[model samples]
Target: MFCCYESGFGKVNRFVALFARQSVVNEPPLGASDFKAAPLLQTHLLKHGQGGSGSAGSNFFRALALFGAGASGLLSCATIAYASDEAEHGLECPSYPWPHKGILSSYDHASIRRGHQVYQQVCASCHSMSLISYRDLVGVAYTEEETKAMAAEIEVVDGPNDEGEMFTRPGKLSDRFPQPYANEQAARFANGGAYPPDLSLITKARHDGQNYVFALLTGYRDPPAGVSVISASQALLCFVL
Candidate 1:
């Protein structure tokens, strides 16, 4: 038997059972000699709350309703499960424009140059793009001499001397991007216990990488009514961005 709850109307566990009891499975087929079976089917159905004659049409419709309710419940459960999964993994940000490969769709070189400038001027103060080197920008964004010059502007830590002491030297094209903090502890201390994430591969790590970054950069606003605000430190980070 099926069970269903109806708000302000009590439980309805007996609906299916009642229908089953009045079902016409055991009844013989209607024939000239078996005219009494029709009345028997009607009598059985009437006992189950179906008023008047229990025609095949009425019984079929009742079954359909029961099936529909069960299916709806299953669908609702599946939807809830899907939503839970999304919440567990964190909600995805809205998609925005990204570079694509096609005849008309290509990386915006001008935008890339401007964005690189922004990263170097603003974001590099806290975040690190350690996976990339100055040499990686050649051809895609910068010329070989420009990339080498940019690398030379930074001082990088190098090998120990014969006396076993580390030394600093001009950064080379092969050297990884420099970091603002020496270690994780220093980073946390500088940011009030919040360690900035590395920006290398960030565009690939997020669901809608470019769009998510753009939204985060510009989406700082008062949350809607009933929305709980984030912690003060995180809120501060958002505003700073």
Candidate 2:
């Protein structure tokens, strides 16, 4: 027997179970067979709930739901449980049809450039992308010349000079992105003892990170009353002209 819970009301797998329990329910199926089956189906379903041996109708539909859920990852008991858990710990994310999605889709270069500009202006104040370098931006978001110019805007620490002294020079394409703070201790001190993590590690470190980040940027809202107690998703990106 498949155990499940229905949230309030919906016309789905839950509706099937709910319908089975009903003495009479309106269903618009185009056939005399549906009418013929309802009598047997109702009898079997009602008996199944009462600890009697279930009939083929109950087993067949439940099995169908299980397989469909496994394949499509929806309409199963597990989906509800997972959603409830996420609702407890985090805000629900609204879906958006992002341009750069799916097998045939490619990155939106102009939008990416704008987003990168925002990251540099605002998010760079707290987050560091230690794993990424300026060269990675070349041919992706910005041209080689533009990236080189941006790299040169920052001063990078170079090897010990002729006099055995470390010196700073204009940053090169090879230099890792500059950090917001000099060290972990400084980072903590500046941010109320909370060390801002390296944004470069987000994709590798977090499950479903791309969606998570997108959610974090857009998931500020009041959850359904009494349904969830949510924690915040921090969004540091700021879009400015």
Candidate 3:
């Protein structure tokens, strides 16, 4: 019985040794770096999908890199757009009459006042200076009495309408400059083929505001020695509009 047990133990040892050798031969060898690189290769190849060649896997990686670069570019543009929106609109305005020279003058309270006077005397018949209120002129160094006096000159429209009747009221500090023409249609009709534009925000809206104004004011000519007369405003309207 001892001899039979010993023989059975030896057979067990032989079987175990043969199984270990077979396992070693069947299993593939892998290094640490190979293990790490395997997931990367699988991911790249999967993006290319089944039946994709090695070259296709490389292309997949290239496409992924381009997508990442494009995403980065979009992020950069968004940052610039955010910065631009945060910047002051007035400071970036093309028409804020500065760093340029013409008859309209630089941006200043005094220049605005002078321009207002010039506008009232020379340009107001056709154009409306509607963006500013009389109250805003207080910063122009006008005394209260002077401001009142100026206000008293213009007639304002007021009162409730049963008859839709018009009544004259003294201009107040809060009133914006009134329109000369009844509306855009009337303005266009009066100016031949062009419409008289509002001057209120002109200095803030136009890039060539100063030169354009200066040129318009001084551009009147006799056409030529024998040519027919054309209105200066007409000529200026052609260039500006």
Candidate 4:
């Protein structure tokens, strides 16, 4: 029985190692240092077998324990490699002084107003803010009268009338922000086969999203030596803050 258990343990270890190697191969080529032995081992057992009560189960548990040491070594290596890459690239972002920085601080109304102006004059040309209506801006950025006036500048397509035809009318406070293009196909055609993403909720979608936007807008610089800048007819606009 002891000899049989030893054989089973060996088989399981070899199988786990083989499985781990395949997983490493399938992972996208991050540098060789990104993979650690422990994650591979843990991943192997997680993929292969659940805890059970027979000799087979005992062998699996024992194999998992043996793999644990190597797994820790692997995790440490991966963490070091990641830290080195970040250091080499200088990818850390600069912090912004947001108006609502502290717990007690209220939003900076003036800054919000300025940002709205920038979005209207620049971002609105290409990106849509479909989730926002003119009425949504009334209390925060503009007065009711101003919001209504702004909405009136755009012509919205209304329903089929008695003639069963779509008709156009001046936009209302209830209408969504007008899209720059009629549809996705038109947008892509106008933008060199690339569709611009909507700006609505963009700040909420990414990690440190607000700072990311601030960094991107202010981050444009000459490319490093030997790198070439490929200019498109319509450049995506976030690079100028």
Candidate 2 all-Cα RMSD? 11.9
In candidate 1, what residue range of length 10 has the lowest lDDT sum? 7-16
Of candidates 2 and 1, the better by lDDT: 1
State how far residue 238 of model 4 sits from its true place (Å).
Answer: 12
lDDT of each: 0.67, 0.66, 0.60, 0.70
For each candidate in turn, give its C-alpha RMSD to the true structure in angstroms.
11.8, 11.9, 21.2, 12.8
What are the per-residue Cα lDDT tens digits for candidate 2 across 147-232?
99999999988979899999999998999999999999999999888998888878567445566677666645554545544334
lDDT of 4 at 65: 49
Best by TM-score: 4
Candidate order (TM-score): 4, 1, 2, 3
Better of 2 and 4 by lDDT: 4
Number of clashing pairs per prediction, in order: 0, 0, 0, 4
Best by lDDT: 4
Cα error of candidate 2 at position 57, Å: 39
Higher-TM-score candidate among 2 and 3?
2
lDDT of 4 by residue, 21-64 (tens): 54446533223233233244444444544333233533565567
115-199 per-residue lDDT for model 1 (tens digits): 8889999999999999998888888778899889999999988879899999999988999989989999999999999999999
What TM-score, over all chains together, does every model reach? 0.56, 0.54, 0.50, 0.58
Tens digit per residue, CA lDDT, model 3, 1-241: 3355345433433333332343346433233444243344445444554332445644554555465456556666887887776462223322333643557754466666787788888888998877877787786746667777898888998875688787889998888877888888888889885887787778456545565556556654444545554434233322422
lDDT of 4 at 4: 57
Give the worst 10-residue stretch by lDDT in candidate 2: 232-241
